[model samples]
Target: MATIFTRIINREIPGHIIAEDDRFIAILDINPLVMGHTLVIPKEEVDYIFDLDEKTLGDLMLFAQKVGLAVEQAVPCLRIGISVIGLEVPHTHVHLIPMNSMGDINFSRPKMNPSGDELSAMAEKIRSFL
Candidate 1:
């Protein structure tokens, strides 16, 4: 079965995509920790981050860095925080969260439920910077 991220990449489901290239995609987290929380993932569906091949892993970070910089510019934050907690979904993903404080990246904190319009607007804002 295709993971949800793969489904998004294939256009099988809706995703508020910020950016993409031949190898990777950056999308808004539907349930975000902050307004610009984005997930950077390779198009290839590897279950674990560490399990990815050396080149793919390196490329993924570079891709994430680009997305992170855009997110930082698009959203108001002190800096973008990177997190790689892959347990929620099987596919390997890095979270690029806009942070104002230490608590901004706390996974245990309740997530913000932004409306579809809000997500779309945020996606557009981030894409503008990319």
Candidate 2:
């Protein structure tokens, strides 16, 4: 079965895409910790980030670097923080979250509720940075 991320990449599900290339995809997180929170995922459906092959792993990070730079350019943040906790979805992924402090990256903290329109606008803003 395709993971949700793969489904999103395949257009079986809706996603506010920030950027994409042959190896990876970037999209807005629906339940974001912050407004510009994005997920970077590999095209191959590897369940664990650590389990990815060396080449793919390196490629994923390089792809994420570009997305992170765009997130920084488009969003107001001290920096873009990356987290790779694979438990949320079986597919390996990285969370490129916009943060002003360490507290902004805490998953246990309450997530912000951004409207659909707000998400759409933010997605476009980030896309423009791409």
Candidate 3:
């Protein structure tokens, strides 16, 4: 079965897309920690980010950086925090979170349950800055 990220990449599941390339896709997190929070995933379904080849891992960071910059510009935050906590889902993924402080990126904190309209609006704002 395709992983959830793969389904989003393949359009089998709807995602608030922020950016995409031949190898990667960036989309808004529905249960976001903050506005402009997004996930960057390789099109390939690798289970662990560290398991990716050096070149591919390097490419993913560069790709995520570009998306992160746009998120920073579009959202109110001190910085964009990059995190790789792959326990929730099997797929390798990077979380590009908009953070005002270190605590903003804490996974233990309750996630924001934004409506679909809010997600769409946030996605557009991030895309506009990209």
Cα-based TM-score, every candidate: 0.98, 0.96, 0.97
Clashes of each: 0, 0, 0
Cα-based lDDT for every prediction: 0.96, 0.93, 0.92
Candidates 1 and 3 compared by TM-score, better number: 1
User: Tens digit of lDDT per residue, candidate 2, span 1-130?
Assistant: 8999999999999989888988899999999998899999998899999899999999999999999999999999999999999998999999999999999999999988888899999999988888
Model 2 lDDT-worst window of ten: 110-119
- Model 3 residue 49 CA deviation (Å) reads 0.6
Q: Which residue pairs in candidate 3 have backbone atoms (N, alpha carbon, C) closer than 3 angstroms, thus clashing?
A: none
Indicate the residue-level lDDT of 72 in model 3. Answer: 94
User: What lDDT score is found at residue 70 in candidate 3?
Assistant: 96
lDDT per residue, candidate 3, 9-56, as tens digits? Answer: 888989999999999999998898887889999999999999999999
Best model per TM-score? 1
Question: How do these models rank on lDDT, best leading?
Answer: 1, 2, 3
- Where does the lowest 10-residue lDDT sum fall in candidate 3? 28-37
